[model samples]
Target: MGIEYVSVDAEYPMCCPVILCDICNKQLTREGVALRMESSTPQEPKRSPLYFAHRGGCYSTISATLEDLYGSGWLELSDNLKDFMTQLAHNFNTPLEHEYTQYKLT
Candidate 1:
């Protein structure tokens, strides 16, 4: 048998918009959203299509990624997702000692 190419749909819908925050969106004329795609072939199984999460945070799926971009002036994050970003920032800023202590104290 010869090597046959196989195509598959992405886990998440592709070409979806990456809505950033208000300011960056307006400044860059971007929809505050980005696009992602994964192309692969059967012969090269390792090359199978994968989730190419784009736009959110330098291409990170984690919603907070968008926030980082927004904070860095790379993209604008929407108010709706701001809280998500806020928590993300808080988490990053939190020290490991505090994290461990929080559970212990509780």
Candidate 2:
């Protein structure tokens, strides 16, 4: 009985006052930049997409984040990364870290 996470967005608002990283077991801090996290916990056994925030893009952060996200065969990525990236031609210039007061974009 394991849990799964789907990180649709690139950041998360911390629910817990003291949140720890699944990889580092250290405090997860979103000092200024918006942090990365998965969406929900759905129980499924497969590949998944994962993103993490650490001390200013430290090299070790990448390795550790991957291991934690995909190690035990819990991760499920519906699309191939290369194919997705290639097809994803448009770019989002910048992202703002703020709460949306309204639901509709237009």
Candidate 3:
């Protein structure tokens, strides 16, 4: 999985379209984190819709799901994803040093 940006066209009086969290099913704001994931089976690989989650708890919950599916080293599998998460952690002022040891770039 990796981070992705999305945009939508909204009508007058509407500033932006609302995105709901995939984990909690609540409205996702600008502070939310969105990830694009792919699933593969014996036949083919399928692209999944963006998964949205709020920072902190919601983010952690979704992360656990990813870990269960892809194992604990999932974040370390992709350099791009690791970099993105590192930047996100800094931007959100959320320390991920303990939760994600690989988040720090060598």
lDDT of 2 by residue, 1-106 (tens): 0113334345874343333344444444442111222234433222233433344443256545555754432222223233333333332444545433321111
**Predicted structure with the largest lDDT when compared to the true one:** 3
Q: How far is candidate 2 from the true structure (C-alpha RMSD, Å)?
A: 15.3
Rank the candidate models, highest lDDT first: 3, 2, 1
Q: Give all candidates' CA lDDT scores.
A: 0.32, 0.35, 0.53
Q: What is the TM-score of each candidate against the true structure?
A: 0.19, 0.23, 0.41
lDDT of 3 by residue, 21-98 (tens): 778776655567665443334244343434667778987898898767655432221223335456656869764333
- lDDT per residue as tens, model 1, 8-94: 346744453333332232211232332212222323322111112224453454335433433322222233344544664797988
Instruction: Show how many residue pairs clash in every candidate, following the order shown.
Output: 11, 8, 0
Which candidate should be chosen as best, given TM-score against the real structure? 3
By the TM-score metric, which is better: model 1 or model 2? 2
Worst 10 residues of 2 by lDDT: 31-40
In model 2, where do residues sit more than 4 Å from their true spots? Answer: 1-18, 31-47, 56-59, 64-106
Q: How well does candidate 1 match the true structure in TM-score terms?
A: 0.19
